[model samples]
Target: MNSHTVRSLAYLTGLIIKSFGISLVIRSRLGTGAWDGFYVGMAGHFGLTVGSWLIILGIFLIFFNSFLIKSKPNFFPIITIFILGCCIDFWLHFLNFEPDGAESQVLIFWVGLLFTAVGISIYVQGQFALTPVDQLMYALSKRFGFSLMISKTIGECFALAFAFLLHGPIGLGTIIFTFLCGPLIQFLIPRIERMLFCR
Candidate 1:
């Protein structure tokens, strides 16, 4: 296959794995990451699936990010979001994995979080288009001269606020994920890149 095809496959694979990890977190009955918390809250409020809310929110974020960056939005991210949304629902529907109790829930949540971080590292290393949510963080960071870390924290805080207002699940897991996921992603990205591309 061509390089483009290979990259596309890698991107899709990463997204599918990410979706599975997210589904695991949700099923664990522990809190999810910020954007996911918002999506789950919106889904509950609107009587839609989490994946449906992801797509709807993703479309809005695409336009919002464009406005913030004062540039044309790259529509390619939509493809990633669409596939991600579908995969999330597919995993949720098909996977019977769930935590059996409080201790198991904590274990499951950490496992899911690690899986998500690894999946994100892989996809980002592939250098395909980013999801709209991630694009928003990049746009804000570039536009305001803030570091990406600060921009991401601010964005996630907003998501958490919305999730709280919408009454989504919030717990220690959310706090843990907010603080740790970025560092984990940074730590894992180089390793994943070496694994995938070092040959």
Candidate 2:
């Protein structure tokens, strides 16, 4: 494969790791941050494990993405995400990452969620196939020429609403994550890209 392709794969691999860590934190059930709050809530309502719900969400996004993005959808990230979710579920099942109980679990959850945002930034920097949520923003941006920030805001608002209707966890953490994640991802994307690909 070309250097570009190889770099993209490496970045995707990193994303899986980061996503898995976030999943692990969620299953710990101490406390979840904003996005995780929604995810966990959806899982609870559906009687699905958090990891399974994540995989389902990723798969659903993959389907939605085919119609939403400039780039043709690829199954690699979806497949990778599913595998990572399963792996994370297993890790949480067997490992005790949170020993201090609820409060400490919340601390770890936030840390993991931050890392999840960072992971997504790195993955995007790879410039591989966009994930579903990203694809939606991309489609909107291309269709209306919305700024990236604007498109992202629109998408997040929609996600917030949907998650809320599903009784997904919306709280102070959700607001914090919604506001901070965009800027944080924006900051990390370029930095990780430069660090890894020197581009």
Candidate 3:
């Protein structure tokens, strides 16, 4: 209706597109991408569709993020991620392609994760409200006076550990994801913003 509304819609659409890419990467069956291993493993355990799990997690994260930042959840990205995640999951049913082995799969996993890093960088550059998990990290760092990077590392480490316990594939991909995502995001966010928005 207004310029602000248009911008928000655009940003939300970008996030959903990013989420759709993520779902495609996950469905690749080469291996679960680093960030997705937790969600996929949980989905497997619960016998629910990955999209269903993603939607549920997205809702919870949005609410939780709101609590941390006092920011209200918007409808666009929330609904988009939910519906697209389910769409991706359903689409994945007809395709089946697992990696060659643990080693080969790990390589594929790393590549998929690199793509995720790029996607995250682009998403942050959009400067929409932070995702729930990102917001939680921001809130924790602000309240505890830790560096945002450190807070993120701590949070990811915990997720990595849980993923391991759940028998999710953890490998060099995990290590690389943990070590590299922060600096990469920091570097790319600004560049992407400038390129996309000239700011």
- What are the per-residue Cα lDDT tens digits for candidate 1 across 1-199? 6557666777877887788888888877889888899999998888888898998899999999999989987888888898889999898899777677999998889888988887777777557888888787788888899866677777878898998999888888888887777778767777876676665
TM-scores of the candidates in the order shown: 0.91, 0.74, 0.71
* Model 3 C-alpha lDDT per residue in residues 1-199, reported as the tens digit of each score: 5546545654555565455545545644543444466777787788787677667776776776566656676544465556556655764674356666666555555555555556666655545555555565676677678776776776677667767777665555566666666666566666766666556
lDDT of each: 0.83, 0.65, 0.61
Which candidate gets the maximum lDDT versus the true structure? 1
* Candidate 1 vs 2: which has more TM-score: 1
Per-candidate clashes, comma-separated: 0, 0, 0
Q: Which residue pairs come into collision in candidate 1?
A: none
Which order, best to worst by TM-score?
1, 2, 3
22 in model 3: Cα distance from truth in Å? Answer: 3.8
Q: How close is candidate 3 to the true structure, as a TM-score?
A: 0.71
Per-residue lDDT, model 1, residue 163, is: 87
Q: For model 2, how big is the CA root-mean-square deviation? A: 3.6
- Sorted on lDDT, highest at the top, how do the candidates line up? 1, 2, 3
The parts of candidate 2 lying over 4 Å away from their true place are: 1-9, 24-35, 69-77, 94-106
Residues 1-199, model 2: lDDT tens digits: 6668866776667667566556645654543444456567777787877667767787777766666655566676675556556766675566654446767656766776677677677667666555656666666788788866677667777777767777775665566566666667666777877777667
